[model samples]
Target: MRSMPNTNTRNLHELSADIAAVVRDVVATGEDAVITDDGTEVAVIMSMADYDRLHLYAELADAARPGYAGATEFRAMSISEMLDVLGVHPTVDRGLRG
Candidate 1:
């Protein structure tokens, strides 16, 4: 008794020439593009399954971080610091490893 997922539509202009790069996002977001000629809509493209999946993920993300606006700052860390934070053992046996 699985219900069919809802589909979303988008305009052709919204799609990028390098869509393959963002195929995953496009599918998950339930977003797509409608090709148009002159003033008439020609075709529609989208990933119903992907859109539903992405939408659900987005809802979960929002629920997980309630009241969090968004990313504010971007910081770069050194390789040693990143490894330490991740508890990853450095492959290179550098005696001076952090």
Candidate 2:
């Protein structure tokens, strides 16, 4: 599995103030950005190349797991389960997904 580079974290207010600069940094440096809200990490901004790479890896991992379902089916699960499958912490204060 390919590891991601160290991510730069910023609060939502900071990101709102300088979205362009943050975007440029992510695009040019290939390092992801973690967006936080009220001290809680909420989102990530990464280059398309990185997203594609991660998505491909996620697909491969899902396929290798026993009783794995198709991508379409996987997408239908609760956000918590999806995050769990993606190796993300389920307790994080993330936006909900149906």
Candidate 3:
């Protein structure tokens, strides 16, 4: 019943007022919704499919880096560590599961 992230950008207050409606729109669009706080991006809502694909890409990219390790080693790295290496903007809280 939650909205998928796509397209429109929403400030925290706007999202807080009607979270369901915003989520509904995102689900219908299968796109990204950028959520901001105080005019700064704070979160994003996106389809799970997109999320999974991104995770795979990240893992693969990690394998090619110097001091590269095997899948087991890469998998052992925390999401934050991976994200840090990928130079992704902070604020993400989820990561691929083993």
lDDT of each: 0.47, 0.68, 0.66
Count of residue pairs whose backbone atoms collide, per candidate: 5, 0, 9
Q: Candidate 3's C-alpha lDDT?
A: 0.66
lDDT of 3 by residue, 2-44 (tens): 3322257888887888888877776676656888889877788
lDDT of 1 by residue, 1-98 (tens): 11122333334565466456345555655445444545456654556653454456544444445354675654555534544554545443333211
- The lDDT of model 2 is 0.68
Candidate 1 — worst ten consecutive residues by lDDT sum?
Answer: 1-10
- TM-score-better candidate, 1 vs 2: 2
Give each prediction's root-mean-square deviation over alpha carbons.
17.0, 9.6, 9.3
- State which candidate, 1 or 3, has the greater TM-score: 3
* TM-score for each model: 0.27, 0.63, 0.60
Off by over 4 Å in 1: 1-16, 21-25, 48-98
Using TM-score, give the best candidate's number: 2
